[model samples]
Target: MDRDLFRTVKQGTRNQARLLYHRLVCRLPHLLAVTLLLVVAPRLVSTLSLAALWSEARANAAVLLAACAGCAAAAYAYAMSRPRPVYLVDLAGYKPGPAHEATRAQAIRQFGLAGGFDDESMSFQKRMMERSGLGEATHFPASLMSIPVDMCLQTARDESEAVVFGVVDELLAKTGVRAEDIGVVIANSSLYSPTPSFVSLIVNRYRLRHDVVSHNLSGMGCSAGIIAIDLAKHLLQVHPDTYALVVSTENITLNAYLGNNRPMLVTNTLFRVGGAAVLLSNRRQERARAKYQLIHTVRTHRGASDRSYGCVTQEEDDAGHVGVSLSKELMSVAGEALRTNITTLGPLVLPLSEQLRFLATVVLKRVFRADVKPHIPDFTLALDHFCIHAGGRGVLDELERSLKLSAWHMEPSRMTLYRFGNTSSSSLWYELAYCEAKGRIKKGDRVWQIAFGSGFKCNSAVWKALRAVDAVAVGDTGSPWAQDVDVLPVHVPKVVPIDDDEASYKTAAA
Candidate 1:
């Protein structure tokens, strides 16, 4: 036993010595290089004559001069080739009057009294309302409030005229931009398109120049605002030193679904009246006065796929009543669109370090076949503010969790939902307005405005603020939240379950 112990100890010592010898051998070149750099390098430098170094520099003068010239030329060429920046000079979100304000209780009582919805449909609407995160202050068009709702082109026109004129007047007033000076007008609405396009409506109302670039985009739902911004950006890029007006509105007075289709009825409970107008310019003179400079606009359209195209659509029910159907596949389709949009946008906006981390994760998951959860790139690192479209409470909830955003980051969207309900394409602007109203927008802050639309499209609009926006939380600043923004940043409960019993619902809504 003593001999065995002695042999084991002798073997362990031999193994340690052998390992140490190998380590020293492996490090020999590095040690020698370090010694030369620390000791021999200084002595060599001391021994070197100034005349020799001067001769070397003189010999390489032509090459050094040529390299510097080449670098300057390259920089000049890059500067000239850089894309012109698009500036958002000012923007306005329509604030409906007190007559338009519709509480959730009002919706319940009015819809119930209207007798349009059967008991089952009414019950579904109540449930949706309970979870919708809407406060008692959302608006509905006056046309919608009429006892027997007037569904006519005239009524729709009235609604559109109100939204379009309201926002445009405010925007024009704030910017002090003249009608004829407007070089381009791009208007977007999902459901209501008149014979004279919305662009024409703006043009005729403002008496814009005959040569003005005009377009009316239709059937592009809630994401249309970003899409309109994208369109305006392109137009501004081409039409140098010009102002472009982009109007986004959806006339919900025409959006009421009288049908009992459960899927279609969701619209009745969620959709509300709202609109926005934005002024964009590519003029160099406008930079100092601009609120934000457009950095990037990315749009992902999944309409080619049948499932995505049909996810949210207007169709006649079995009984021949027309309504918009919010399919079960809608969220999944939106998710797919959002995934594609963010992936494309990630490379543009994410910092180099973040991009590298995301790339490494992709490599690990795809190339290495490692067992790992899919990496959700931390967007908060790249963006200072997020104006996620407040389409509904569910959408906000899903994005908050998926994006790993804090409550502060989501406050704008949530408060918008609570205060304004779902304003469709203009909802994103309402959210942005909330931030502006709160004086949260600071100079150099990068804001990411993301929205999902009915063409099954996901879109992103990125901006960098020029200066801090003042807290315009009162009067008519064209912000829907301006009137009540001070009382906001309210604590919205995770779930406010309402009673299912019919009698209890009346009291709950009240």
Candidate 2:
């Protein structure tokens, strides 16, 4: 048995070596170029130094100079060919009125009675909501509990229009940019779309120019905001001096599951109505007025793996009620996705010290076959602020542990989850608003926003603050957290018990 195990291990090592060799062979051109510069170039120069070859020295010098010039031009072109700078000129988050705020008791009573959940399902949802870390102020659309169930469309429309119109108007007004000047309009929503599409609605409502390019992304879950930003960045690269308006939102009313499946039930407890609008410009003149400059965007998708692909998915339950389900392995899957994303992002943003340390560990393990644990780079050193996804309490806890982050570093995510629950793709913007409302973001500060979504995907966006923004400047009308900004960073208990009569009755029935 011992001999067989040793043989298996040796075979695995050989296979890995073969794979590495194939990869290196694919990069042979780059390796050959590097070898010419380091090895052949110096030897050629030295050989030309002999006085016997003085006559040929001038030709060799010209050849060497030409090679050097070619290399410099290639490097310059690679740098200049990169996408143009995309600036976040201004942004706004939708603030729902008091009528939309739903407390735990309210959700328990309203959803429990209206959703027609069985006693066991109600009990399970009650427990889930208690541990959700959401406050009593999370908003919900009025159409969520319509008696006839036919009002879902109207509810979705009302909710989407309110959020889209409010945030876009606020963004345009704040940036002083005309609607007609927006060259690109991208809107993403995880649920519900009217015939004209959300992007079309924005164009019509704002009277945007006929030539404005527009796209409406549907079914891309909570990470769609960053994905939209990535799309806009690419568009700006091709279309110079253009403005891209990205609206990220999720409509909960139509997507809300009225089923008994525990996984589906969790969505109803966590997701709430919210939206955000971000104005991105590639025009150089807008840089001085911009609030933040987009620096890096890294996205990782693990959909090929069955476990990750099914981690979060929308499917019909046994009774034919359709809803998005959160799998038991969601946290683990999300952690893996985040690891993949940061692995790519670390080299781009991490300081030299951290990069060297990570490189040393990787070299030791790969080349020396050292039995060393892989090091998680100190991302805090690379970013001043972190807006991790507010997917749920467990998601936040896992990220904190994986990234070795402190409580203060996680304040924005925590507070956003507490105030807004999981607003899907727009949650990161809400967290950013919270940071801004608290005056935590300073000029030149690097803010890193990470999001995990249904594709078992992790996406990250890094921004450098262009100018200082004071908390006072973030008024109640400007930010969803503005009204209670001063009272934030508050202690949110892990569990808030439901004390309403309905909850008591449900407990008695159970």
| Model 2: how far residue 184 lies from native, Å | 0.6
Candidate RMSDs in Å, in order, are 12.5, 6.4
Over the stretch 439-494, how does candidate 1's per-residue lDDT look in tens digits?
Answer: 99999999999999887899999999999998874775556676787688888776
TM-score of each: 0.82, 0.83
Please state the error at residue 329 of candidate 1 in Å: 1.5
C-alpha lDDT values of all predictions: 0.83, 0.84
Worst 10 residues of 2 by lDDT: 1-10
lDDT of 2 by residue, 464-510 (tens): 99998778453567777868876777898888887775556465334
Error of 1 at 21 (Å): 48
Which pairs clash in the backbone of model 2? none
